[model samples]
Target: MREPHRTDSATATRDTRPVPCRPADARRTVRHAVAERCRDRALTCAGQALDDALLVTSELTTNAILHGGGITGFDVAVDSGGVRVSVSDRSDDVPVATARPDEPDRCAAGGRGWPIVCRLARDVRVACLPCGGKCITAVVPLR
Candidate 1:
């Protein structure tokens, strides 16, 4: 006679809760998410995609710290297609328009983080939070 196997949904499910991280700490959180999510899966170009993900993570959090009065919330979700990163902060100003590179006078005050983020992310979105801030979501494709 064989004993029956047990399945634990609570233990198996990944916690989908929002993780509050400092600007510098978000990257590590992403790295861990990527590693855990990619453990069994295989992607031929994961290296470059991972780099892009990390860069995007750095830019969002750094921008929050520098311009948005620090990060309020952060979350990362890794799937077979890509990694989705959401960074929330305390600001209402638009990231791209406010710091458009074509306008040298205003652009010179900021670094290249926004442009880099826009270029690397497959899909990017920004939404105003009801609590008086904004959230930026960027999805970097793994393929």
Candidate 2:
């Protein structure tokens, strides 16, 4: 199992807090827990934003697998302000969001993922860490 990266408290303030979560199925349960926190805090309306959060997590995870080589684990953190989803993968390659002008259909699925993530999330960040790995995080504002 891969270990979570260590960072200072100052950095952690802006990060997803690097929670240990299973890369596969457990991510769903973890996401649900975060969504529930959002709900309990009254940060969002409940259903729609939770769906959006899940979708963003799915895209980030898929990007980790397809472009960042593969992932061993991921994290989801929620506060009163927003929801942060981060997927840690084995490659340092940065993910670029691109849509071909001529072939609009080229992004029908795989490529469209980033676009959706960008639109739904208030902020998006892609980090290529020095240690031959990457973390893509999306911050979706509550309500």
Candidate 3:
């Protein structure tokens, strides 16, 4: 997981629902749905940025399973600028996006998730709930 990106709060609204992405398969499906629903909602912002949004969702969900202890639930929201995806897990460790310069090969895996999310999302945020959990969110812009 990575640190949530930043964007002005004045232009976006929160739209979230419960989803299960603890399992690898479920996470994949959720990622797909983030793009699908975003497009279906007629949120024009999603059309051009769906791929980045999907990638961001995938990373967040994957982090939830690996670091957050497990994906208890998740949600998706969209605004004029782009789509917002949120994943809630059991842990409170805030994810920080870091740049790894050692890996010259851009195709390498393992440490790119957070960096990717930060790059793709217009804004990313993480909030800790009182009940031992946290929600990581990302907003991807349209074309």
Go through the candidates in order and give the clash count of each.
Answer: 0, 0, 3
**How far does residue 90 in candidate 2 sit from its true spot (Å)?**
1.5
Flag regions of model 2 displaced more than 4 Å. 1-27, 35-45, 101-109
- For candidate 1, the TM-score is 0.76
- Who wins the lDDT comparison? 1
| Runs of candidate 1 exceeding 4 Å displacement | 1-21, 42-45, 97-109
lDDT of 2 by residue, 24-55 (tens): 55356546656567455555536777778777
lDDT (C-alpha) at residue 19 in model 2: 41
Compute the lDDT of residue 82 as modeled in candidate 3.
Answer: 65
Q: Sort by lDDT, best first: what order?
A: 1, 3, 2
Better of 1 and 3 by TM-score: 1
Cα TM-score per model: 0.76, 0.71, 0.68
Reference-based TM-score, model 2: 0.71
Positional deviation of residue 21's Cα in model 1 after best superposition, in angstroms:
4.4
